[model samples]
Target: MIIINVLDNFQAALEAPRVLSLNSSKYFSGPYGEDIVFIANDWHTALLPCYLKSIYKSRGIYKNAKVAFCIHNIAYQGRHAFADFDLLNLPDEFRSSFDFIDGYTKPVKGRKINWMKAGILESDRVFTVSPHYAEELVSGEDRGVELDNIIRSTGITGIVNGMDNREWSPQTDRYIDVHYDATTVTEAKSLLKEALQAEVGLPVDRSIPLIGFIGRLEEQKGSDILVEAIVKFIDEDVQIIVLGTGKKIMEKQIEELEVTYPGKAIGVAKFNGPLAHKIIAGADFIVIPSRFEPCGLVQLHAMPYGTVPIVSSTGGLVDTVKEGYTGFHAGAFNVECETVDPDDVDKLATTVKRAIKTYGTQAMKEIIQNCMAQDFSWKGPAKLWEKALLSLEVAGNEPGIDGEEIAPLAKENVATP
Candidate 1:
């Protein structure tokens, strides 16, 4: 076993993995026998062909190597022009699967191939971060982009991600001004909320239900929806504190709201980890109204803080947050029936209003306790991953070098390159 590190000073190319794929993978891939090559997310998966060709050229077709692809998000697929294929050093056979084609046309209009698609097809085993997200990627209306048919033909396994409890615990987190546990959460919340309000220049009133938004200011994170519903949120006497940055338009809108409704809405358009931790601790409820969340760690981070999450029922958020139990689920999708529509402002307003009304009540206290009580440690999820990997290893080595059982999967969607 050998590990080689390739370092490039070009930052721009690194951001666009497609540009760096060939060079990076050429350095990373090597000839090996009975080995597993695990690729992570779209960034590294863009180099699938490069890695495969390198390994196969040196080790031959029956080298007994299996590739595992782990998908964090189906969005943000690394797409590049067909011209760039020349640089990949791959055999002429990989063109069709790696080249993008428009699925809209009957004849299939050729566009740019999505690198994520290539990785999924090339992978011996596909794993997503959460079970619900895995199902959503394959079966639902909001399935993975241009790869659902292939995913259904093949199969994907989902494992719910576990949170790092030691780093995220409110009781022990050094980021927060106050240390708190489930028993001390209420009093700590009150003090921190007041302090946070003063710091952000919002009203330091303990009665107002302060909801926190700590993520990217993008459509997926529902930043636009939150901005749109600001008047309504203000109407309900709910104060909002947002900490993160993204789209300029959304940031402008948030900034405008802060100006429009002084002491009600505050947007800090920057990435500050300490502030994020403080927001999770101080805010009564953390809001995660993402359009499609694969496995959101924000809600997990919030749970242990006794900070209830108001989430859109999708992906890992749906799996983690129990409706009306530990947290509130805004009806972005019907969890039971698997239907989706644009989130309604009125519905979100109602949900926030309900949370505001229930704030500080015995019921809310119980819910907070439940949120804190729930376990999301890595122990179980790690074991599940280990078992899956072991099974794949066993399956791959069954027929020795003649490995026709697993070899058939390689021919899945590849056109004659």
Candidate 2:
């Protein structure tokens, strides 16, 4: 009900300018949403585009406005009972837009309404976080979550997300104790690693290769696979630290690793921002074995800190992590389902071993230098976004705007919910 009311207020605001009066002395006027480009993110605000086309546009309101739908993750689509569609108070003609039938089930469940499907069909443009993720979404039903056909027809754009260099940089990070750039990373990391080992109750040894894992302990994050892989190196010269909070089973599995191998591993099943920074700064390598990543920020954060990443070669991981240059690829797995694959576990273990072999060598230093030298900041990605948004303004035109584009106008009018 609140969402519906908010949408109604949004439409009203767009339909006419609002006047603000100060005690008979001053007045302010809000813009009547002209040439505005609305950006609806995920399922929560999916109905905004539909309302614009069906109600407002039919009555000649916000006619020049365009809406772009951004899909951060396709797994959740705001599925609800078909009968609940009445609560939206939409026209009967728009019912088909939200209608969805789940054919994968054995008993063939009753009809449901999907908000994301409607947004995809109605929006002017569709976007995902990364290029590889965009391709994967249109490739098949497995990654697309049963919306591949619609996504393919609509044509989605992909732009890799960027990190805030100011906050994530080793020299400027406020969370970690020690700070260093590429040149001083080796000595600084040695000190951080020892400090981290003591903080996490592990034996402080600078020679041991410290590996870190930080993210939700969910099936999507491949936490089970990580635990399985780390178990293989219990008796080895490696040290592991994991920090995250999710799924009781996964949390228990991580705790078991700490109990089983006290010195080699420690798992803190909670979110600690400072601890996360320390782990990234201190660890020689960070493992991100996600089943599917739509432009992961952790690898971007890890690289600048001289921490090599060992990741699965799927989605944004493929785009960001260069094998043997910046990080090691753990091999891409067929993401047909959420079940953990034994092969993926083996592949990750092998990649970890490979990364361990490169440790403490001049080759390792070169890789670290390469990782640090690369830029994952917002400047490049911001330009790509500018190009994408401007392309919307000139749909069929060739060689759109110059460097000084209408990016500011596009940025100013974009309303996201």
Candidate 3:
């Protein structure tokens, strides 16, 4: 059974640089002797699309193999049970409807064990998207006891998410007005001007630096800090571009800022794929002010396009964005964010100014262009899972044991206002 867990991938990747292949087995195929297992990225909401994909893959290739999903983020809030066929994309931003449902209903936590229960019992092996995410399931805050039991019984592994080089390549991107590799800044700048301005819905002004931001509007990615930073820098000469929608407090502020900033601030609060790539390719600088980024693709995407990133030091951002090389990093800030205090905003603004200064200078831009040329596609990530899935031996056994399954409760469904 070949399974690809893409829970809510299209929406999670809505504002990502390119549209990820929803067609799972093709992206994650077993070489010859290997069979695939299934999982979802989000359990509460995006489960159905992935489930459908697994069903499709099973029918075509591994008809006899049992395919199932390792519920993604089952412990996101707490344990919650997921309803059958809750896969259709639902809008939670327009109204405050999802609120009473999330806090009171407690949906996400309900599906924790059920998701794993299904994965371990049915799948030869369970796979996650990232090593970090895998760790969470193994030894996460909520999964402490259950994770161990699952390990004693069920086998699980983390596979770093992959990117399509075809879509992300700088050598040939229609999104950028100028197509250049590491050695062609002159045309890139021209391309940056026309392509970015048009892409972001801003006027094509080569004179000003175009700034870009794309991600979920939650504290996990330092969404709160980013909101503050934007508000702080709204009066500056730079053109700001934002994508994606999440959380009421953050989303409302962004909308208000859009009204306040007008043409200077461009935002698309829906699932838009192509526009995100254009923004990433066209922008002078990309921002990933994450509070705790497990493994971020945006910063990776940002670099290839000569888009210097300004990220918070944590998780994947720290691993990918080297200071003064691909991007700049500010130190630790948690969910509560007491460490960020008032001085944090100044530092963020300073970082942006510095990155802009770096972009404006001919020598610095060349340095940035050099960094972006490096590859970060699916080849490496796919191989890790490819080996795991094809091997199918954890502790020299194929069938892993089952742990205690949690009682299904109401789950949480999230969206932006």
Per-model CA lDDT versus the true structure: 0.71, 0.81, 0.56
Query: Across residues 11-85, which tens digit of lDDT does each residue of candidate 2 receive?
Result: 654454323222432232345334567778898778888778777788886667778799988988887777767
- What's model 1's lDDT at 309? 91
| Candidate 2: regions farther than 4 A off | 1-32, 104-108, 336-338, 394-417
In model 1, which runs have C-alpha deviations exceeding 4 angstroms? 1-34, 57-62, 103-109, 140-142, 333-343, 394-417
Q: Could you estimate the TM-score for every candidate?
A: 0.80, 0.88, 0.62
Model 1, 1-417: lDDT tens digits are: 111332222222223332333323332433333344444555454565346545443567424445667888876666656665665555666676677765444222457655677777766788898898898888753456556776777799999988777677887777777898888988899999999889889988988889998888776777776666667767776899987777797778777868888778898887677778778888999888777788888988889988999987788988899988899977764332122233555566667877878897999999999999988877677678777776766333332222111112221211000
RMSD of each: 10.2, 5.6, 12.1
Judging by lDDT against the true structure, name the best candidate: 2
lDDT of 3 by residue, 228-263 (tens): 777667677788877777777777766665677777
The true-structure Cα RMSD of candidate 3 reads 12.1
TM-score of 1: 0.80
Question: Model 2 — which ten-residue stretch has the worst lDDT?
Answer: 408-417
Indicate whether candidate 1 or candidate 2 has the larger TM-score: 2
Model 2: lDDT to the true structure:
0.81
Clashes of 3: 23
The TM-score obtained by model 3 is 0.62
